[model samples]
Target chain A: MIPVITAFDRSPDGGKGLARDTRVRWALEEAGQSCDVRPVSFASLRQPAHLALNPFGQIPTYEEDDLVLFETGAIVLHIAERHNGLLPVDAAARARAIAWMFAALNTVEPPILERQTAVLLESDKPWTAERLRSIDQRIDVRLGQLSARLGDDEWLDGGFSAGDLMMVSVLLRLGSSGLLDKHPGLAAYLARGEARPAYRRAFEAQRTFNTRPGPSE
Target chain B: MIPVITAFDRSPDGGKGLARDTRVRWALEEAGQSCDVRPVSFASLRQPAHLALNPFGQIPTYEEDDLVLFETGAIVLHIAERHNGLLPVDAAARARAIAWMFAALNTVEPPILERQTAVLLESDKPWTAERLRSIDQRIDVRLGQLSARLGDDEWLDGGFSAGDLMMVSVLLRLGSSGLLDKHPGLAAYLARGEARPAYRRAFEAQRTFNTRPGPSE
Candidate 1:
């Protein structure tokens, strides 16, 4: 089976590839693996069948043969581990790559998500400005540490791996915040990941999905 | 060569096993691996020596022979991948277990961390209560989903794997929030994980490091 998964019925990003599914799609495309998409509304996602695939009722659960997987990090890692391109062959390098993946999701992404929640949900709150500033500062600290470590390097570790893929995905969330431009090297690094053909393909694919006419439309 | 890493000279948790180092210690104990602990003061963590091992200046980096890995998920996964007890034998089952690991950190822990930050940094902000409520709701949603999926099951996915180890570590952060109590099942689940002998050993080890009198004390 060509592993099928869900995508936003319509992405909040206005068809941008910022959706989590886009990352998995990009990984599959990069690996030359064919896959399928199942567009789901927020309502449909809560239904029993979708929840069965993803307990979190989130997007991009991968299904292949007897294996079913959720959590984009795990799915992407699965692809990276099974295929050759996304992970390094050397054991130490591979471990570091996985470490970066965890760091991206676990460490870097948290503040970004907080910033997003602040923007999307709490914009009208009295302390929105203060909360936004604090969250952004946290992002800046993490980015500063990451930028210092990455200094003048093309990717996180050695060659591009799932680590870079995940880091770029997390960093892309900073698009509107404009905080990324504060560090020219990190900005360039994000651009480099976006420049990948696989990323472009994934972007367009999600864009197409988002733009597709809904039943009412 | 055995791996040794630093702990807080004086833990913010005051030897309650809430420090990040405890997770690493627990994984080590579960793997039945003997390791050394080198306690470091807050002043020392940012110094060049520690930064060389962990660029992010965070806890639980692993050092074994030529390899040094950061990110607790990476370190725990490394131990799980190498050792027998932490992971499973079958391929698909192993992948699912890994998915739970990602879900715990990426999905579950982020909101809890936000709650911590709100209390630590943003508690005085006018919107603190609202911000906290939103973060708590997000956490509760994840827990509700996880608890429903878990549905009286013992461990996530299957017999205790590294995934459970990680999930428990992440859930432990909610100790102060009293959010876990919202779901009796998850509360019980955490209690069971804490009951493990290895977890107790790991807790005591880190407690020893945490409680040991520092020069400042």
Candidate 2:
């Protein structure tokens, strides 16, 4: 059964991959799987209909056959696991790849999200500058560490697994912040991920959704 | 081979399970395994010795005979994958459980971490309150969605798995915020997770470490 997932009718980022749905779309495109996107309004998301598929009432809940799944990472991972392209055959390499995936979301992405939060919610706050510095520093520290490890390496672990997909998606958030430019390797690394045909496909798909006109009057 | 992970010499929370190490400890405890704690000072965490194990210079990196893993979610998932208790035998259920793990870290924890950043680094700023509200509202929305889904359900999915362990750990961050109390089900749900014997053991172990004295002169 073809899985259907939800996305914002219009993303705040002008359809940049910052939206979580982009990750799922990227994964589906990577796996060579075609799926349907169900655009949801903020109000409708809270309704019982949407809530049932995703208890968290978030975007990108996967419904395939009798199975329903939420969480973009999980959905991406599910796609990676079920299909052959997203993970390597080696057991150890696969585990390491999965580790990188967790690191991307759990470790690297937190500070980036904080930066966005500061910009979106606290720009007028008195402590905004200090908070921004701290957030930027934390992000730099993580980037420096990751850069050292990556050290000219292509992907985080073995070849481009779902881990790379997620990591690149995450690093893309730093585009507006300019913090990523400070780390040359990471900057180049993200460009490489974006250059992927699948990524371009996924980006275009979500962009199309975001730019599309709303329902008829 | 037994895995030895690091813990804070004195957890900032004074033994509260907020310490990331608690998650790793919980995983080990639930797996019916015994592990060692190599407590590290904040300075040591930055030193080359500890940095070799975890590039991010964070706590709760797992070290077995040959493999070393960082990121609590990754380490916990690794432990669960190798051991029997934390993952389900059914493939689909297992996928769902793993998804929850991703959901907990990637989806749920990000906003909470953002709130923490605002409180810790931006509290002195003029826009602190505004930023905090925006961040908190984001978290609140997520929590509301989660609360509704967890309504009466004991755990996120079937019998307690790594997913619940992660979900509960993420929810515990809201303790001081009082946001959880607003949703009785999630609050009680968090309590159910804390009430687990394994969770209690993990909490106490971190507490003991945090309360213990440092290597004296």
Candidate 3:
């Protein structure tokens, strides 16, 4: 049976597929799976029903027949583990791939989110510029390390796996910030991830969801 | 052969077991695995040898013969997957447990880390107090949601798993800030986690390592 996942009624990213749901979508698409989407408004997200599925009241909560889960990393890992495409078959390689998944979400994404917080929440603060600078510096350090690691490699490990999918998703947040351009290799890397047919479909699906006209429009 | 994991030469936590290594160590103890700890100084962490092991040049890197891994979440998950104690035998329960692990690291810990950044990096800023207040409120939102979810529960789910282990570890970061106290249920929950024999062993091991006299001392 197909699983269902929650997404934002209106993504803050507008038409861009930067929402967490897009990660799960990309994973599903990569795995040749079809699923259902349930969109929840900001208010409905905090409601008891949605909270039952996701205690955090966040989007992209996955619900199968008997099992329900939240956290995009976990959901993606679940899909990848159950299916065949997103993880390597080798025991050690798979562990390394999973490690990169955690690195993408836990290590790499933190400072990027901090930069977003600085830009979105603290722009009016006097320290905004300095905060952005510091956040960017931190991001650059990771990018430099990542670039060194990725040097001429197609994927983080062997071939494209969930690790690349997650790293590319996290790196995409830096697109508008113009940080990707600073490292041409990473820019090319992100481009490769986006070029995947699965990613393209996922991006388009989220775009349609975001751009659909409503009474407010 | 015993595995080797890196730790801070002189932990900033001063043996209180707040560093990320403690999480891995706790997982190892829970699994009844004997491993070697290699302490890496801050300067040495960025050196070529360490960078080769961990591209991000951070501590708590796991080296098991042919495999090298980083990220505390990944390391802990690795130990749990290899050992029987930290994960349930049922697949669905395991999935749920892993979701909590991701939720702890990605969702819950981000704001806590933000608070840490504010305290350590931006404490002298003119807006420090107000910024800290904002950060704390964000943390409180997650804690409130977590408290509601964890009401009257001994562990996060059916039993003690890696999920609870990670959640308790992440919540420990908020100890000095007194944020966990606001949610008495969650605080009690954390106390129960600390009461585990595995946690005690891991904490004592890290404490001994951290408190060991330096050459200069």
lDDT of candidate 1 at residue B206, scale 0 to 100: 80
Better of 1 and 3 by TM-score: 3
Chain A accuracy as TM-score for every candidate? 0.97, 0.96, 0.97
- Local distance difference test scores for all models: 0.87, 0.85, 0.93
Query: Who wins the lDDT comparison?
Result: 3
TM-score of each candidate structure, all chains considered together: 0.97, 0.92, 0.98
Off by over 4 Å in 2: A124-130, A213-217, B123-134, B213-217
- Deviation from truth (RMSD, Å), model 2: 2.4
CA-based DockQ, model 3: 0.88
Residues A93-152, model 1: lDDT tens digits: 999999999999988998899888888888887788876787788889899989999999
Q: What is the DockQ of each candidate?
A: 0.89, 0.67, 0.88
The deviation in Å at residue A93 for candidate 2 is 1.7
TM-score of model 2's chain A, to 2 decimals?
A: 0.96
lDDT per residue for candidate 2 within B1-217, as digits (tens), equals: 6788988766778888798999999988999998999877787888889878888888988888777788898888888999988999998899889988987887788888878866886677677776667777888888887887776889988899999999999998887897776788888898899999999898888888777775611
Quote the positional error of residue B170 for candidate 2 in Å.
1.9
Q: Determine which window of 10 residues in candidate 3 chain A has minimal summed lDDT.
A: A208-217
Instruction: Place model 3 in a CAPRI quality band.
Output: high
